[model samples]
Target chain A: MDCYETRMEPGDRLILCSDGVTQAGLGQKRYKFGWRRSGELEFAQNIIRKSPEISAKDLAYAIAFQALSISPEKCTDDISCLVIYLRHPRVLRILTGPPYHKEHDHDFAMLASGGANDVIICGGTTASIIERELHTKVEIDLNLMKASGDLPPPGMMPGIGLTTEGILTLSKVCTVLEKKQQDKIPLAAKAIINRIMENDCIEFIVGTKVNEAHQDPNLPLELELRRNIIKRLAIILERDYRKKVTVNYY
Target chain B: MKKITLEICCGTTCYMLGTQKLLQIENIMPEEWKNCVAVSAIPCLNNCTSENICGAPFVRINGEIMSHASVESIFNRIRELLPGEGEE
Candidate 1:
């Protein structure tokens, strides 16, 4: 074993992929997602090309799943990705819907805006309500984060905040939590999950208010209530990461 | 010999109220007592709040809750719980 040391500059992404990613498939003849025979480099480059500002969790998934997407008969190997982000203090606040009743919007906004360094809005209507009530504009760069089907990319809310699809993304996040698997998560959920992992303390201000529009019978059971998803995520964060997770359901 | 699992609350409130100083208890412990105790920092016991009987600066010894915890209080409890040991 050789011990090597190198200085990492800012904006550096170190991708340490296992052989399953490098020498994947049958010889050099096999590659997935339209990459050259030099599959490993191009494969990773492809994921990065899709979303250059990709989170560690998502990037790994993109590669691993693509490997799996290859004809299973050809690709057979264990995949593992160890991502290390230089470690920074992150305080993320996730705001879902407004309070169950209309009267509590004021108090909801107050607590919702409480003490988090960063914010992520899970619902479109919730963003509108926050915009109206708090007078903050929700601006999003769709190109920054790719959008999945029926779900738009995460948008920004001017000041240290981002917004995502309500039931659609929340449903995906819940599945990630339930399955206890982080791979192949939806883009928005992957971003939030990675953000959560970046932070030491996280606050969740979930509105107990249920939206009739979101009560679609065709939706997944957990998607019906954002509160349920928030609570469940809180539990996982606390139990798994041992982070200071405070979920104040307003 | 009975062992003690001590969980120190590092919740925001408790951390603000002086949880850092509580680590000193482990340092001042007698060798015999130190060997029997395992101290770990807990994110939040969900007990510290402005409106509850439990607030920050908490310590739990073998699942025993110690609210508004202090080095003196925790040591006193340890002395009481120590097997066959009497207060010095």
Candidate 2:
């Protein structure tokens, strides 16, 4: 089992494990593995030390990966994992770079300089491009390099479907912006949207609400842009997939 | 002669388990079967919660679900369905 301790607000507790724990001691045959893990708290703690860096979600997967590495050879043993966390946080990470030109530098500098928690643009030409464009440094998730050919349209990322819920979930994770800062949104989104439109999986949705929302004076420009961008992205996603896209405003 | 059509679901669950790569069936098939088989892709079979979701890496042939939708297995199945000289 993988053990975790919550360090952030909204104190949460989590336990992760390989399928071994679930398969080991359960009376029922069907989904018994899940139920057993649900009740076994102390046993879960015995497997690993507290992790201060990994989130509850990542902790679970990390444990699962660790177990897979150590498990007996030649046996599948139903490798699995269990994650328990009181609450999950809404996280948004935006990456931008590979400047178009030395004269026309590009980066998600708008977000970085706007008081984002992390700044990841590399030093040198990459950092220079971002620095020239925006005010602050944003932490870069190096893992993004693994991303392959053109990103799928707005809601077409792997494991994300075209359903209303899926669309809403993806929208929540992505940072949106008004057309004014059109240059600020991730290039991947635009590339993906173009492909989605090409495949007829989605279409543009523009109406008084979307138009008016961007015009709202009460909301900050960033917040307003954030809100409407999601709507536009959703309309495109729904149109292409031929489905209803839903959103939850918090 | 019986023609075969293969359809793979790209649904959320399947997609997460790496169904995008499963779409290489057309390329994997032998040269001769190209004219006899038609391969297509769709998003979501709504089979997310199933335990087998992780293994699908799934194909539907003539409307029948083929389990363990691996590249090798699919190649064999396509071969079996090809129009040929006689009974096996």
Candidate 3:
């Protein structure tokens, strides 16, 4: 029973291993390379020597392979390594429905059509409006959407990030967002929601023009209005995820 | 040499239920961890409606989902995985 309390310092190297790596085969002239301290270090240095830029994951695999190759043809114990790294972020902007009046259409279209930010157009009508206003094309991707029932699948515009069904999908997204169940949501919803969560500041560009025809008479009282749903989502992003939720109404 | 990506849920339900308070963690996080653990805000982590029903205030350590997250809870977890190497 040996326990060393050495603390970790930059440039310090440490390795932990099981008997499989250090054990010697009984009654044989063979001794594992990892059986000795020098051999073990040499093994690791050789990996780094071969590829100076190898990632942690690749390095783990390289060591594991060497350990297993000590007796390649047959039995060896389980071997493993853990490597980790940090990450960074971005923002998400969703442009759904349409502007309240036709006059704001040009400005809304121009504002939402620009690049350098991830943009999502939730409603089919909104996508068309943006397409017509900007003279860009929107191609619907029928195969990629989730279980949207009557709503059409997601679409792609010339410069926009994503385009999908409006009311039906938004309602489902709100449900999933409330439920916090990522898998139950469809692909389009999943992508947007994932992006929303993955970022520090998520802005929603909501087109206030109400689409009365798409509303289902059977909808629950809460899901009936697009404004309410978008607002509720904004509140969640603000309160729950702690993201900077900006609602820009067109 | 491991970087922990701490993803906090900023979705409505979590926020409404008080997850907003968790945001302060960014300020109090040990300076050394700022480089090791990159904390980011996410819209929703889905603990509210899942079968487990862990409720609001959720986060993800790397890709592992954690329900009912808090500053103390998250700090303890991060500390375990990355105990301070003397405040770099």
Candidate rank order under lDDT: 1, 3, 2
Order the numbered candidates by TM-score, best leading.
Answer: 3, 1, 2
DockQ of candidate 3 compared with the true complex: 0.01
A1-250: candidate 2 lDDT, tens digit per residue: 8876556444456465555644443434443444354444533454434643345556666656544444444335666666655543322222222333334343233433433222222112223334346533222222231242222112222221121112222343333322323443343344433333234222222111121222333322223343455566566546544534444331
TM agreement with the true structure for every prediction: 0.45, 0.33, 0.48
lDDT of 1 by residue, A66-102 (tens): 6656635655666666554443456788877667788
Tell me how large the interface RMSD of candidate 1 is: 18.2
Winner of 1 and 2 under lDDT: 1
- Residue A36, candidate 1: how far off, in angstroms? 39
Off by over 4 Å in 1: A1-90, A112-114, A142-150, A178-183, A218-222, B1-88
DockQ of each: 0.01, 0.01, 0.01
Identify the leading candidate in terms of TM-score: 3
